[model samples]
Target: MSDHPFDVLAARALRVGAYLVRADDQGRLYDGIGLKPEHWRRAQTLLADAPEPWQKLLTSDPGDDRIILPNGGHILRLSSNRRGRHEHTILAVIEPCVCSKPLGQVLSESTEADSGCTNVTTPGQCNGCAAACLSDPITVECLLRCWYEDLFKLGRQESELTKLSQQLAETYEELNLLYRLGQELTVSGDPRCFVQSLCQDLLEVMSFRWVAVKLFDLPELSEQLAGMFVCEGTTQKTINEAEQAVEALAQMPQVHKPAVVLDIASQWGHLLPALGNSLLAYPLYKGETMYGLIVAIDKDPEAGDISSVDLKLVGSTASQLRIFLDNVTLYDQMHLMFLGTLEALTAAVDAKDRYTCGHSQRVALLSRQLAEALGLPPDRVERIHIAGLMHDVGKIGVPESVLCKAGKLTKEEYEIIKGHPEIGANIVKDIPHFDDIIPGVLYHHERYDGKGYPHGLAGEDIPMMGRLLALADSFDAMSSTRTYRAALPRERVLEEIQACAGSQFDPDLTPHFLSLDFSEYDGQVANHKAGDPGAQGVAA
Candidate 1:
């Protein structure tokens, strides 16, 4: 065959593969790869017609090197390496050009010659190519093998790149779905509805075959978080199968251990009967405590689809779900703490005055009843109850001489006593835990008519919880006994509660507080201090 342009050039360079490089005039060295004056000579010959300096000349090197031509004209040196250890020998081998499938198929189908076919030389001769022109008989053989390895390696790398791209795309889509689901859960204040949405999202977004969420039962929680399962196909048979598997898992005793189990069928043969071929179970934990387990089962027909790497991804996803559940639990705990502290603070205030040992508690109980009667928001009602409980907490700073003087306090003493609202507000201001409740305690004493102390924020300007607490506090104070006077009659207390509606109490809240049975407060007060209005009062 007549020599082609690439073949002629490659022959002159004494190299096996086609490649090119740019020569550098400035000599420099890094290990054996360096620039020398001889490099510029070869480059000058290749581009003889070029301008002076020859800084950008394409060079013909009898060495292994690669050239990159940007925009098809500007050539540059990409890489170069030594091919021989002890001699001035180099072969410019370019990155393998992708071979056509026809070429590969031919090579794969060719039979080995009787001469052992130890190298590509024998195979080339069998294919009727000139054997003498090809360099060292063994060289041709080694080159053929090397090219074959490189071709397959390139194909594998391309495949891995495509796979990673697809996985990244899928991850982005799942993250978007997670964000939307979080929004829906937040807006869905109904616990059951939130959980239902969570279950559906876990199935639709995560592609889990079976998903179940269970919550830890606690005394403070009025509603028990039952098992919620979502699956593509969850019939009685499937559920029974799942239940049996759960029971079997339960038998594997782990003392408060939260764990993730993979390929669970291998460990529990019983799981095989009902479960998919692959199972991944993650335990939901709050702190170090395991609340429950979320199990994802996959029985896809393709075995290769669920690899160890895949199971790890599923486990990580389950951890995010666990975090959401933990946050819900935390929210509940915070709500409870808010209510409890408010109650304790109110009780502490009542304890300071012997005559009102049970007064604060009775008012709180009445305030809760009134809040419900007035159809107030549950969260608002909760704040009101807390405010009522701690409404007199500032009294903790009040001296007993003033509280139990058994006589009307002078204006100076009254003014000092009235500062309790601001003082109580400041006491809890530093506690970030009760952010919402502090406002109620601070403003509960303000009157609707703008006559109340500490910034007389009037009417609707007063926080609804504060207004509600003001009405409840007044009702309890009017009905209870004091050191200087006997308890007022129930009719008189009701008349006062109604007369002061728009002025002293929230008009809407006053009627609700007036509707309560005053006898109930008297009973609670007597019961609370019956043992020792003296010693028990001392404890208060």
Candidate 2:
């Protein structure tokens, strides 16, 4: 038979064909097949004219025609027509290759070719039927083509799979970084640190070139947008470009509310060619109030020119970051409003009588110091500070006659004085974010040891902040000149605080209250106490 393509090509493809026809399919056989050699077209074309049933011979059932291969104990099958018979009479029998497998696999010994009968085709007899198949020329050509096509496809698939795996690894890394940034933003309380950390994460993980954040400053009744934070990549020069674009939009006589440059490439709307000419901005808003804008900048000018994938990522990430910014701004603003209302209430209380100006401010300072001394977390300390400032809020409801009385109050008047804590709690009860502080304000007068007034909460039952504030409120009251008494000396005030520990104050926090350094605030206290008569209540 003509030589197979396996005989002519590189060793790898030839080894693959050799392995596929092994006697028992053992080790080294498959490796031998993978190392098969390739043959040229000139060689393959000569074999294509041969007349073996090459397709059936290579892949058909072994039972039909079996040739026990020489020396090696493998059964190979080939079926062909018998020669010199009636024109085309077929004698189906297994036949082995006549040529030595020096170009294929090694054999132990030369074997006789299988024509039809076993006796005539013994190991010692004649040439194999491959001689007959080779002389015909059609069989060898078809088999060579089949093997080559399969190997090419397998190599291509392996290459593609490797690329897909690499891409998946990169995507996982990006998601992990985002998750970590989310955790940091959730735990962090400071807005500036939170935003700065977020920006750094976007630049490093998401590959954003430039990012900027702005906040609304209410100069009048209307909010004026101001850029509070901006971060740009080292490579990118378009810093604050988005802000300039928004500012330009605001200046146009045609648009009223702030205009967003959603797609910058378009000609009709706001355009700034300098700002990388590409923009994405999400409004930081809470209800009707516009807090600010978050802008993500890229250099691509045409919409089609920018990556749709990257743009989607920027939009989603910006939305999440915007929520965080809006939340923090709302929290800070509400805190300010709480302080403002507290001031108004304190002023109303002072308006009832001139004797206690800046009373709440003093209480607030002392309460904060005491809260710190107790090693409270900053969040709790903040709540305590607000509670201290607004503790006297209920006093706003007290009558002027009772507040300014110079002598000891009647039993009826003391009852009216005792109602302020409840009144203060009631006033701020409806305000969100003030609920935690309400207990401290309403219950500051309560005794830690169950001996004080109002609910007379005992021991740990009194809130730590309320207990701390109780000491501050009591000490400040004694230290200040009231309608009934002259101001007490610092030494006497410290002694009184020590005496009331565990009884009127949380014993654990009393030492901190006594240790407070009064020097820094002494002048401010004296100045506020020396209220200008002209400074009446603030306008509603």
lDDT per model vs. reference: 0.54, 0.55
lDDT per residue as tens, model 2, 21-71:
222112111112212133222122222333443233333454544232332
lDDT of 2: 0.55
Best by lDDT: 2
Best TM-score among the predictions, by candidate number? 1
- CA shift of 507, model 2, Å: 3.9
Candidates' TM-scores?
A: 0.53, 0.52
Q: TM-score of model 1 relative to the true fold?
A: 0.53
Off by over 4 Å in 1: 1-144, 159-201, 218-280, 285-290, 297-310, 318-348, 361-382, 407-419, 422-439, 449-458, 488-496, 511-527, 530-540
